[model samples]
Target chain A: MEFQGFRRKDGSVGTRNTIGILSTVVCANEVADDISRHVEGATAFMHQQGCCQTPVDIARVNETLIGLGKNPNLAAVLLVSLGCESTAVGEVAKAISEAGKRVETIVIQEVGGAAKSIAEGTLLVQDMVQEASRLERTSCPVRDLVLGLKCGSSDTTSGLAPNPALGIASDLLIEAGGTSILGEVTEFIGAEHLLALHARDEDVGKQILDLVKRMENRAKSAGQDIRGGQPTGGNIKGGLTTIEEKSLGAIAKAGTAPIQAVYEYGIAPQVKGLVVMDSPGREPEILTGLAAAGCTVIAFTTGRGAPQGFPFVPVIKITGNKVTWDKLRDHMDMDVSSVMEGEETLPDAGKRIFREILQVASGMLTKAEISGYTKAMDIYTVGPVI
Target chain B: MKNDAIMIHEKDNVATALRDIKPNEKVVVGTGDKSSVIQVQQPIPYGHKFAVRDIPGGEDILKYGEVMGRATQDIAGGTHAHIHNIESLRGRGDLER
Candidate 1:
């Protein structure tokens, strides 16, 4: 269960050593992206938030950025900011520096223009990468692993196969004293009762139910039904009907473990067994939320096909469609389609997936990771642009 | 176990195809007491659905014991139950519907 990994000064273990160029607001995304383009081994964490949000929402944005910079996977961080943006770029750099990683900041307004900021940021990132390359991995136990669970573009086989297989893997990780996080609160609407059964206590169970209620209310107030935009076209073509039916299938990814805790979007889980994070169902937002929560690896289940991965974490894409596996082989990591053809049992598929997770954790890159499909990541926001 | 295909729940009148059913290929449904063997009108892919009982126009198509969509036209056993013949009842645009 030991894998070679970089140990961060904050005491967190990371599978990948990366230098991150983070944009403090939407305005500075171009600068960060430009800087990242010039620097090898550098990834940009760009998002559309950081200005004119309600105080609570602004704080949430600020916290997620700071957390991303502090993530152990990052060997160093460079914050790119627009001088007028409300997001606290200075505070973000201070937090990451305190976590013991090299941290620096570049403000476009103060730096004169985008060109100058990009030049300065690129040089800064190159230096960080040099420092990052000097760091070496040490033996880390399985218990230190933080795993994120997510499924997108679902179809019938998702419920029948990959999700349950992932559940088994989640259970195995938890049994090894690792942390597993389940996200996408909207999908839990119809299946909340099932998940509540796994809560650590009645209060946790109620909290799980309440989160579902809030999601439903948000949709309702927007003059839409929860099912209005669910089970999407791909899902229906793949044979899922109601939100209830999809939920029934979705919960299989949790395996059969007790829910140890629940967390808000982008909040790190305090205790680890199986915890739920409140996140939207979109790939970019949810993936960002999970990574910001400090997951070192992610197990993503897709039925139709989704190929995006995060900047610093390894995403293991598992699919149940043999056709998708063969057709999109370049994008997918593992195929449990054998479960559908009766070539493999659920447990057998689960074991195969678990082994794959171990392999990836030990430095094997996923197909998405290999193709450099990490640019489509963003933090979810609910406010108007300002 | 009848093994033709499972209805998933008692409330569902349609069953998903566990394997591909070729056009005009005959398949059986239900058990001996109420069994019926019908020919597929068109090729239906695996993981897709076939009508278990007759579904008239405007009736909702049930699968997994819930309404997946409403039948836009009469659907018989062994016919593909998807967008061409069924329309989503949950998230349709009013004018389009």
Candidate 2:
């Protein structure tokens, strides 16, 4: 299957040709936002973590910035720096430029002030957007598509209907030679063993288990019972009583495909099929990791309704509860409640969802995209602030 | 339609209610050969569970064909199974405590 996509100079295919105004630190966000507001087709990557951290944490921050700049969705990148952060801006710029994209930079201190930096950044962004706009979509194979899977606000219907239906959709994508990423390592706690059985090799299986154990150790270090934090209050209200229960349901989203590889947070998958990304359970942070990993679109399953989207990627929401569908129809993209009604078989529902993914990849805007659901997203870190 | 609540598996003594069931609503259990009707003891929310058979304290409560938690108190047939009556013991507790 082939769809129209923008071809990047770096030999990557982009579903969208966007110019990004990336802020190096939270202090530089206002300037970046101002610059983006002045340029059509420009979006800002604003976050809270570009400074004040340990060396390892700082390097992670640098890697994430470089990853976002290298994302195939971006046609060009403009780095807006505050001139005094700990982030290695030079290294990030070098990496993006080496990836074959036009990279521009501006420092607030060097440019005299926020107003001056915004002016310089806006001019750079406008020129980039004009170039980005000139790029035409060309035929790209389905294998070029990378899909990110996420779920939040889970309910009883999630385990029984929605997540499993998503699994079917995932299987279809993998069969078509497309890549699907199952993230949120924290949610894979009790279900890691089940997923490990599908790994490509024994070593990969061990790595999958290792990621799960690492997450458990993090929770244990915090000295809180993981169950107390497992099914949030919302899950309990929606009939989920424990993390084990949630994990069983969550694993259903991975489908039956063999696990191809395991990747660190915000790192692109090395092999084609279904891959796991080591990430936190928080939706915003995990979504940030996914976007940095170069995912062009996100398929999110929810039973209790979540109206959140990252800055650049389109989030397609699916639900299996007729109640949530009716209540959040504006925010939701597809309804698999028919699964519960037995009106649609699992494969039939998966086909419908796969069709929707194709349409979104070809530029059919999602409800989140249309309603401006671009708020909850930030880089995750393991160190203290300042 | 009366047996909308399903056991999920043979080990489960509680069944998940498919719809909002009001107190005193008529409900039937099991297949045609041995099915029986009983009145709902209280209003059960959609997706919540109700006892299909008698359950004693410390016994595991099953849902989605797996153990969800343990019963904190005895529950008679048709009684709602929830936090008030069940204890969730699935993950590690805070070390600080």
Candidate with top TM-score is: 2
lDDT of 1 at A58: 81
Quick one: best lDDT, which candidate?
2
Instruction: Please tell me which predicted candidate would have the highest DockQ against the true structure.
Output: 2
In model 2, which residue pairs have backbone atoms overlapping below 3 Å?
A: A223-B94, A223-B95, A224-B94, A225-B92, A225-B93, A225-B94
Clashing pairs in 1: none
Q: Which stretches of candidate 2 lie over 4 Å from their true place?
A: B1-3, B28-39, B95-97
For every candidate in turn, the CA RMSD to the true structure comes to 3.9, 2.5
Worst 10 residues of 2 chain A by lDDT: A220-229
* Residue A293 error, candidate 2, Å: 1.4
Docking class of 1: incorrect
TM-score of each: 0.88, 0.93
